[model samples]
Target: METCSIARIIRLQDLAMYRHKLCSLLFRLLPQLQGFPPGPPLKKLCKDEHVHVALTETKMVGTLPELPQDILMVIFAALEIPDLVRAGSVCSSWHSAYARLCNLGQYKQSQTPCLVYASESDPDNVLCLYSLAEKRSYKLTLPQPPIRSRYLIGSSHGWLVTVDERSEMYLLNPITCEQIALPSVTTIEHVKSIFDEYGDVCKYEISWHTGTRSSRKPPSIFALAELRGRLQWKAFVFPDTSTGSYIVVLIHNPQAQLSFAKAGDDKWTWLPPHYLYEDCIYKDDILYAVNIKGELHAFDLSGPVITMKTIITIPEHYDCDSRYIVQAPWGSLLLVFRIVHDHDLEPQPGASEYWNTSEIKICELDALWTKIKVINCLRDHVLFLGHNRSQCLSVNEFPALKENHSYFTDDNFLWTVGHTNNHRDMGILNLDDNNMEEILSPQLCSNCPAPMWITPDLRKMNLMGSMSQQP
Candidate 1:
């Protein structure tokens, strides 16, 4: 009987210490609860005082014990990215919980599309992320090597692919601050310096001079010309890297040809050239490209030797002026077209001179990739198309976003000399109503990079064996 009584007393003492520590943590975490009664004042209890009495007193006055970690996790998981970050700083347990939830990929469930833009005046290579759901803007600085000095060519799986002045490539995750350096510029087969002894020539200057002298210029003359530069990456798509190997497809050079390189390969491998290539996408381990004639070509990247096959040819009567291919959340392919009106070459007083997106047409491809069906309504899906990447999100995942609408940024001929600072060209296209509404206002910085949609994700790349070159 004596031993049992001693054991009970020891257990009570440990419980008391735990309760005190938890209350201290809570008090530090929640400052607003300072004025709230913090239970009976700590005092030396008499030998006769029962442990039940102390626990009952704490139960009546303290609120920390009522909220367990499991319950707290559910609450934290529902918070937006910004709020969740703040909650992690409150306590060590909460921070651990946040890390666990992130490892489990629960944070991605709360993510929505955000508009990422760069400020011409920000010296620290900062990019602004505007949240459509919260209607707020967050400034984020990318990690080294300086991202502002590089050109953003593509964005996929929450990572931005940037090419530096020397034509080197890097993958940057603005949200996680993680960066992966891909193969060097010289690894590309056809990448050569225009100025032989200048080490590496600036391709932008060469392309700009060439564009100025061209007579029969393309409608999206400036954008297409810039995209065709040798140093410019043109377009790139990142594949799933969880399988220990991944392929990066790029359309580069003045000819806009297709090339690819495996994750650890020292050099890029050239594929059969597709000139005047508008866009490319990777769906189910296969690469697909669209040319000026709206012909779709597929490449099987799963094999040791990549083989290209012509899959679908869009009818010439559809009159595909500008084309982009996007895969829906449910694994369906969509072809989006931007139809423009070619008015007089000269501008009139009080009128916009640049060509605008007069109409948008969407077409759905069958599983066999044989027939194309025109889709007037997008149902519950919203599409975001831009120079970086084109993606589709289901309205069911983000209820705040409007359904059957297309959000677009500056692409192709939308950016002209006179319309450099205008935001009126980029807007939301309502597929159901056939109405376009301006979504973002013009920024004060005139040289800001065109805005693009970025989906926040926290997955880190396996860069253990990857090669990197110092800038």
Candidate 2:
């Protein structure tokens, strides 16, 4: 019995030494396996060679360390804004990299234009940002300016210019939830104050027409202006705001008179009124506008006193309904003309009272304003047209977008019916072949605000306080 016990003891010692060496080898190979559960003492594990083998395999297959920061940044930079934001949530290192990229403006290069539509579920405050590349919609909620009574009049440089029922103006960055209030409505030249019996301003009236009226009460001019047709306010923001300097131009009332305010102004300063201004755009630090007569004028905001110069006159055309001025991505200015025909003013059986868009005309303006030419083909570019803002984008940057198309939404003439059912009005217009087709078939509820295109930008802006207070 003593001889047998001695032989068993020797064998057990050999097994223990083997197990110790095996574990040592694994730890050397994988430094990441340091915190792994320690195996049973060799004496306890001597009978189970299978467990020893299993542990060895497990330690050898340990997970790899996280990717390096520089390498992660390169990968994240290529991702779209929404995806990049999600990646930042993975860990602290990734979030730091995202912040650095935003500060450096690296993410701006990866952004493609997105169609911003009012959300059907929460149309008042929530907006749906639809990505053409990803074929998805992201819901965004506004934090300020009380979107319920506000109207989005302009979108540019990632900011929306909104006006409320009280004619209060606000600049809001939907992405960052930043807001800046512009000059007040009482500051406008055309607004007349109506006081109460106590000598307090109770209401305000906009003196749209100054001339004498007919004997008849003119078909309830207020309702006609609100429903059928009336001039709408349009605003344009200067491209550069790095030095805390920016200008906003407003086309006021049905007369389309021009007024402007600077960064520190407390009131809007009226410029020499122009005749029947239709649309305005800001390009190359200058404001360009078009009138009902299709005349283009450039307003210079460089000096304390703003100056206006007539640039070019659009060739005369019949049944002209509306005009829009847009700046192309390549710095070219374009005039989009909407022609309407009212052959049958009366509605027939099952007929709707919507104006038919007979034709669309595009024209390019020369830099010197000496020449204007009609353009039928938009080479590698797509135009987004609507009431809020009109913009042109190049397809070379957005490979998923179709080239040479014009996407349109509802305007005053087509507002009687919702955009979803008005297939004849809102859709993509093939500039190459002059064909119109439906792009979105959303089941939007009636009276939903029309969608607009907004180019996502992350640049920081100098935001003042709310409308009731100054910065």
Candidate 3:
């Protein structure tokens, strides 16, 4: 009974507060409706059966009967995006006040990294977002008949690079449920499509070349579903801020070849010097790629002819599943490595299908790449690594995030090789003290796809839509 009274009192307080806020907003409504700079006496206060406004010479008064916040939200939701934009301008304090009702609140979302994974119990069209701020999962439905099975090769900015069963690559905005189709794998330089008797594309023939175009390795035939796993490894996107144009860079298989294309391009342009690239990042109008052996190369793409330069190479000795190249919060390049040991988790003795991870060793390098500088602390920042584009975020901006720690997901190729629940390979590593902070239980993520970290971004969704409409 005591708790019920407290809850009732809190509800009454909220009702009064929201009522006061709405009454204040009424003063600005007329100015906004007139499309003027705003400063007008309401002129007259009149009461009507329905919500309306009028003016009298003696005294201008605007009146609004008190309504529940939920009822107000229902009314606000009836207004479209344009109306919401105007309504939001009435008061700066209303920017995030009851944010969900404010469609503009999406633009103000905290840039916290959320985990995108599947739910065992939900339909295939639905996915779950494990938000770090709330520490809870929410259901998000994708536009689909149903995604039988999909693979996410990369996440950048706020978009996810996803491949469907037909081996077609496309950009997906999980927040807005917008999808943009990319050039087909058939348009790639070395991949050709093969059609069946009914003229349906059945398989793709992929090849790699050496000195001359005539001299090349044997071509391999892969069905549509199997092609993405073999052909595409990771994808990165760079969107032009001014033009809203964007480019997607792909690090593919067969010695980690490189290919890129603009959003409206018809085909992929193959970049030269196919090194075994483990990770790549774009910063300061330059592209930096790192190989498995820890060699960094910079690409110049501004001129008519693209040029590449080898920056520096470090001799790596530790065993690791993957190496990532990321830009620091201070705008410097850093090479990070997570050393891990795998254990066979298969029920059968000889099966190598299921693998689990055990250890971690985070390493950094000097500017020259000749000296190994083991970073012990991240000070007010948190690092997110794995399938998502590697990033460093300030703890000051995200108070719930662990300071001086790296949150990673399962990027083990072994887990992707076949069907297995190895999502247990994800956890947070405390770089300050060099200890494993937490590893999620296998049961919590058993039904999902390989877990990936996607930084929540709503502003990019608008840019994505505009880019797709480009000529």
Using lDDT, give the best candidate's number.
Answer: 3
Ranking by TM-score: 3, 1, 2
lDDT of 3 by residue, 306-348 (tens): 8888887766857776888877767556677776655655557
lDDT at position 45, candidate 2? 26
- Which residue pairs clash within candidate 2? none
Q: For candidate 2, lDDT tens digit of each residue in 1-471? A: 354345334434554445333323322332323334444332222222121100111121233334456645655656665555545543456666766776665554446667666644664677666667766666666765456445666676677777655556788766666778888776776565567799866566555542232223232223211321233356666543323456677766546677877777899987665756767876445778888887888877766667888888777654567788887777778888876663344668887555555567788888876777888878798877765567777787777778988776655433522233333345677766667675565564224345666666555565342111000
Query: How well does candidate 1 score on lDDT at residue 365?
Result: 93
Model 1's lDDT to the true fold?
0.61
| Per-model lDDT | 0.61, 0.60, 0.64
The residue pairs that clash in candidate 1, if any, are none
Against the hidden reference, what TM-scores do the models get? 0.73, 0.72, 0.73
Ranking by lDDT: 3, 1, 2
Against the true structure, candidate 3 reaches a TM-score of 0.73
